[model samples]
Target: MNDVYVVGVGMTPFGKHPDRSAADLAAEAILGALDDAGLRTVDIEAAWVGHVYQGMAMGQRGLGAAGISGLPITNVENACSSGSTAIYEAATALKAGAYDIVLALGVELLSTKFRGALAPDESDIEAQIGLTMPSVYAMRARRHMEQYGTTPRMLAAIASKNKFNASLNPLAQFKKPVTVDEVMAGRLIAEPLHLHECAPVSDGAAAVILVSGKKLSQLGSSRAIRLVASALRSGKLEVGLPDMTVEDLTWRTAEAAYQQAGLGPDDVQMAEVHDCFSIAEATRIEGLKLYPLGEYPARVERGEAGLGGRLPVNMSGGLLGKGHPLGATGVAQVIEIVKQLRGEAKDRQVPGAKVGLAHCRGGKARGVEGTACTVNILTI
Candidate 1:
């Protein structure tokens, strides 16, 4: 099998775009990535698109808008992990020698899709019980507090750090730095989680160009970021009473990714984790083994996870401040890491960074910890 590298990455500014169609957003992202790769429409061998609520032939519509057609375009919808899953499929094809150059695009125009809080599919018993995304995280926050003495202020600090990081990212949804006090005083979505602590409903798109080792050699581009590992796993069924604060699914997926990359969490210099909620950041870092269990909250308080700290997490403001555009989120996380590894993340750059990790967990279903979880390791 051959290695795969991300030769190009592009994304639209994440925010409410009531007038933009999903196809428009996707087409823009695709063109940007093609330009970034220094490639043209005719260079792509195949394509895969990740989307939900975009209706049938979403990939075809988006790619057609970009003037790309007649190529195999697989559509993926693994909830929020859809984007990363598309990347995984593209890499898989490259490794299998099915195609040398592939495009993985993720797009979602969520502003026009739904209003108010997002919930699990109605088929899910949990959704029937009034379980919303925020409420689920709120319950997890409560569990973390009970297990580790975490305070609401500590949770707010996570939001503050991410939002501050967002201020440096021109494309982020919320570019202004928010204060912990402001976060704490924000409207309550669920107990222990304020509106500021939750990821906003966003509309955006991101795309990446994946190439085989042979393709990379032919291109001879120094801008490529090696995709050292890509691991995806579904949440296991909960049995008996288990610790809700711990993320077994994330650990399993991350472990697989580390082994595949031949690098552990300690080797990662920066990370873009799934911080759909303030507390999710802490739990994800701990689960990824980037920090000791029950210690990330204090680590944030001491700025250990800040831009210039020991390990920078969510330098793109993450989902909390960067905005979570569902299908687009996972791909956007990889884009941020690629930028950071390439020394192009100007204001939020983690200096001397060599390795980065991107984690994305999405969706909620009945009797599962999560719907899908993905871990991708990238290196310069």
Candidate 2:
């Protein structure tokens, strides 16, 4: 099997873009990736696009706007994990030797589609029972506090950290860091979770170009990063009540990624995990084994996850600070990790990053831990 490499990555500024369409955002991101890779659209043999609420044939429409046609284009939707799922598919094709060069793009114009806290599909019993996205994380936050002695202030600190990181990220939604007091002052969305602790509704796009090892050698692309592993998993059905503080889905997906990469969590120097909520970041890092269970909050307070700390996490601002454009999010996470690995992240760069992880978990169902989870490992 041929190893896949990430040759180029691009993402649009994540925030409200009421003037733009999803297809337009995708075209911009795709062209940017092409330019970054020093390749033309003609070099791409196939494409995959991920989006939700963008209607049918989104990939074709987006690619058409970019003046790219007459190629195999697939549209994927797996809730918020849609973008990462597209990346997974592209890597699979590269490894299968079916495509030498492929494009994976994720875009969402969420500003026009919805507002306020997003809920699961209405058909789901959970949604019917008034289980909203914020409420889910809030419940988990409470559980973490109960089980780990984490404080409301600790969770507020998490938001403050990510917002600070966002201030350094030019493409992030929130460019100004908020204090823990400011975060706590925001209107309460759920018990113990204020509005600032949640991810904002955003519109954006992200794209990545993947190539086979042979193609990498042919191009002599010194900037390319090895895509060591791309693992994806759907949440398992729960047979009994499970612990809410921990993420079994994240652990399972990371385990698969670790096995494929032949490296443990300790090998990773930095990460961009799904930080859709302040508490979500802690559960995810612990699930990835980057920090001990019930200890990430303390680690955060110690500056261990800061940019210059032992292992920086969410340097691109993550979902909370960077904005959550649903389908565009997972791909954006990879874009950040790739930039960091290449030492291209200007203000938020980790000094000596070599290995990075990008994890994305999305969706909620009645009896499952999560809807879908994806873990991708990249190395220089």
Candidate 3:
């Protein structure tokens, strides 16, 4: 395997756009990324796409719409981590010396018809148990409260801060900021989680162009956000131990990435982690060793993880604030880091950002914490 660097990035405003199909939105993002790279779609050697809800061959339609040439294309799906899978695939391909320039993308246009998530399958144990993502996250929230005495007010504060941050992002889905009191009084969907505490179903797309170390010069305007390490792990029943879980998978993945990059949490200048829910953000921080178990909230309350904190996190508002377009989130993370490194993130830019770490996790796969996770560390 060889070095891979992200040289370009793009994204659409995350929100309801019932007028556009997933293909159209995805193509828009691809065009933006190509323009950002000062290249044409024809320059792409291969591509990987991730989406959880789109119908058959929709990825092909996106590529064709973007005027991309006949290249090997792989469509991927890994629930919420779908977008990250696209990034990992592109990096792996480039590292193998198979392709010098590759495109990694994720796009989704969620509407009210997102019933697939609600559909039940008799043979599926969780579906049989009626355990949707909201319910499962709610359970986790409950456990956090029962064990650590985490409060709803704290969760509300997290939402409020992220919302304020997202207000500066022109492409963010929600611009209206909220008060902690408002969040506390907001309509309750699941106990301990007001409407503001949960992520909204959003519609958007994000894309990025990656190149091998040798092909970095192919890019015109943008410089390299060198992809230092890419690591992915899936949970297996055999790995189950008392402390073993999907959260543990994040730690393992980050460890591998840390070893590969020769960096640690202390070295990371910024991060855009998977924050599908409030508790998830806290737990993941601990799992990644940014803090200890059950210490994230205290760290968070001290403003240690905010925009000007020791290690600023989720400058893109994360999924909770910017809206989770599921498939697009993973690649969007890379896109945001590219902007931060390039000094192009006008408002959300992290001062003196040079090293960044990011991740995306999704669904209940064969794991204790459920689903799979993909992590990457980058430097410029």
Candidate 4:
């Protein structure tokens, strides 16, 4: 297999834009990525797109708008991790030497229909039983509290910290800094989660270009960050795992990625994690084994996730600040990490960041794409 490297990355702000469709937003991201790569439309060889609930043929529609068509543009729907899954596909194809230049795009334009879209509507019993995303996450939060003594305040602190980070981001949906008290007082969306703790309905897209190390000459002597590892796994049953904590899928995938990279969490200088919600970030920090299990929430409360803190997480403000554009979020994270590696993030940059890690997962605590997840490590 060949080595893969990210050549360019780009993103659109994550938020509500009732006027925009998923296709147009995605095209803008593609253009931005292409421009960043200093390439033209014909430079891309293949592409993969990730999205969900955007209606049929959405991938083709979005790609066509980007001025690339008929190049094996496959659409992936892996729930919230949709964007990350797409990135893994692009990197895998490049690593396998099937393509030198592959583009991955993640886009979503959410409407009210997105709320109930997860139900088993004309599909399964879960949907018929009214199993919505919020409730599923709420259950996880509740369980975490029961088993680990996690609390609403801890969850709120996560939200508040992310919101504060979001304030540094110009594109985020909610830019104002929030406090734990405010999050606690916020409207309750489900059992233990206040509405503020929930990821709001957002629409946006992100794009990235992956090139084989052999193709680095195309960029003409610019310092290159190589893709050290990319691993993806779907969730499976694993008893005894506490709620919202590390899952077997991400753990296993990270193990493979770490093996491939010949590095561990300690090698990662910074991370662009999947913070679908505040608590999600806290749990993922443990799930990814970035820290000991159950310690991430407390660290965040101590201002450990800030820009210059121990691990400087979600520097692009993450999904919380960057806005969760569903399918596009994973790629956006990649974009931010690339900037970190290149020292181009300016104000939002992680200082002297050398090795970076990015992870994405979709859907529930378990099941299919919901359980599906990917972890990638990159370095210059």
Question: Every model's Cα RMSD, please?
Answer: 0.7, 0.8, 2.2, 2.3
TM-score of each: 0.99, 0.99, 0.94, 0.93
Q: Write the per-residue lDDT of candidate 1 for residues 186-219, one digit (tens) a residue.
A: 9999999999999999999999999999999999
The Cα error of candidate 2 at residue 19, in Å, is 0.7
Per-candidate clashes come to 0, 0, 2, 8
Model 4 residue runs over 4 Å out of place are 115-122, 221-223, 238-246, 365-369
Candidates in order have lDDT scores of 0.93, 0.92, 0.80, 0.79
> How many clashing pairs in candidate 2?
0
Candidate number that wins on lDDT, 1 or 4: 1
Models sorted by lDDT, best on top: 1, 2, 3, 4
* lDDT digits (tens) for residues 1-380 of candidate 3: 68888877888999887888898899899999888888887899899999988878767888888887578988998878888988998898899999998999899988744633332224657666676666666677777766777777776777777777788788888898888899889887667777877788888999998888887764543577899988888755545254431377788888888998889888888888888777778777778888777767666667777787887888888887898888999988888888888888897778999998888887773235656788888888
CA lDDT for candidate 4? 0.79
Model 2 clashing residue pairs (backbone): none
Ranked by lDDT, the better of candidates 2 and 3 is 2
Off by over 4 Å in 2: none
Error of 3 at 106 (Å): 0.3
Please list all clashing residue pairs in model 4, or write none if there are none: 81-361, 81-362, 106-328, 119-127, 120-127, 235-371, 246-287, 363-370
User: TM-score of the candidate numbered 2?
Assistant: 0.99
